[model samples]
Target: MSAPFLRGVEALAQFTAREGAGAAPARGHIERLLVDGEEHEHRLGIWYANTKQRRDKLNPAQRTALADLGVTWA
Candidate 1:
């Protein structure tokens, strides 16, 4: 992947880690990652399922954002 894409994935991983710790994730940053990291749906879904609370925090708009990026949940 390109460097920016890799960076986005890194940011997403950090966000997921923070969320797992019960911290409020940086929403804008994570959204940007989700938007830019379009090819990472599987990774994103795995991260989404990493924490129940964090997963629950994804609102309808966020789910729409993910869907726009072609991310889908099974």
Candidate 2:
């Protein structure tokens, strides 16, 4: 996977770990995660909303990955 997309997945994983599954983040939600020995911040909710909006555009692998993460709507 591309680095940025990987990071967003990491951010979502972290958010899920912290907030539990099925929690819909707010529009301004932010997730800070450690990835590749560095810290990165993801605009979690915005990314999520956008992902939902563009769900049909995601490739199978991307969709599968999100589904594996317990993202029901993915």
Candidate 3:
């Protein structure tokens, strides 16, 4: 299960790297990093301008939720 999950994450990471590298919005960014000591993986999405403008922006937990397929923000 972990192997397949990792593969999917790797694929998404690759796609994001190749496509989002140039097309990511100026105010936003997304990247993937191995987490939980590399046994687990996560994606990080950053909205710099939104954070700057909203001092009370939603916390990570509140701002993120698992999709139908079960991906979550880290």
Tell me the whole-model lDDT of each prediction, alpha carbons only. 0.44, 0.82, 0.39
* Candidate 1, residue 74: how far the Cα is off, in Å: 9.8
- Candidate 3 wrongly placed segments (more than 4 Å): 21-74
Among all windows of 10 consecutive residues in model 1, the one with the lowest summed lDDT is 21-30
Who wins the TM-score comparison? Answer: 2
Which of the two candidates, 1 or 2, achieves a greater TM-score against the reference? 2
Rank ordering of all candidates by lDDT, starting from the highest: 2, 1, 3
Off by over 4 Å in 2: none
Worst 10 residues of 2 by lDDT: 1-10
The TM-scores, one per candidate, come to 0.31, 0.86, 0.28
Candidate 3 lDDT over residue span 1-74, tens digit each: 24534444453455455665323224334444555566433232333234334535544443332122233322
| C-alpha RMSD of each candidate structure in angstroms | 11.8, 1.4, 12.4
Which structure among the candidates has the greatest lDDT? Answer: 2
How far is 51's C-alpha from truth in model 2 (Å)?
0.8
Please count the clashing residue pairs in each candidate, in the order shown: 0, 0, 0
lDDT by residue (1-74, candidate 1, tens digit) is 44543453455455555565333333323333444556433343344444333546556655554344334441
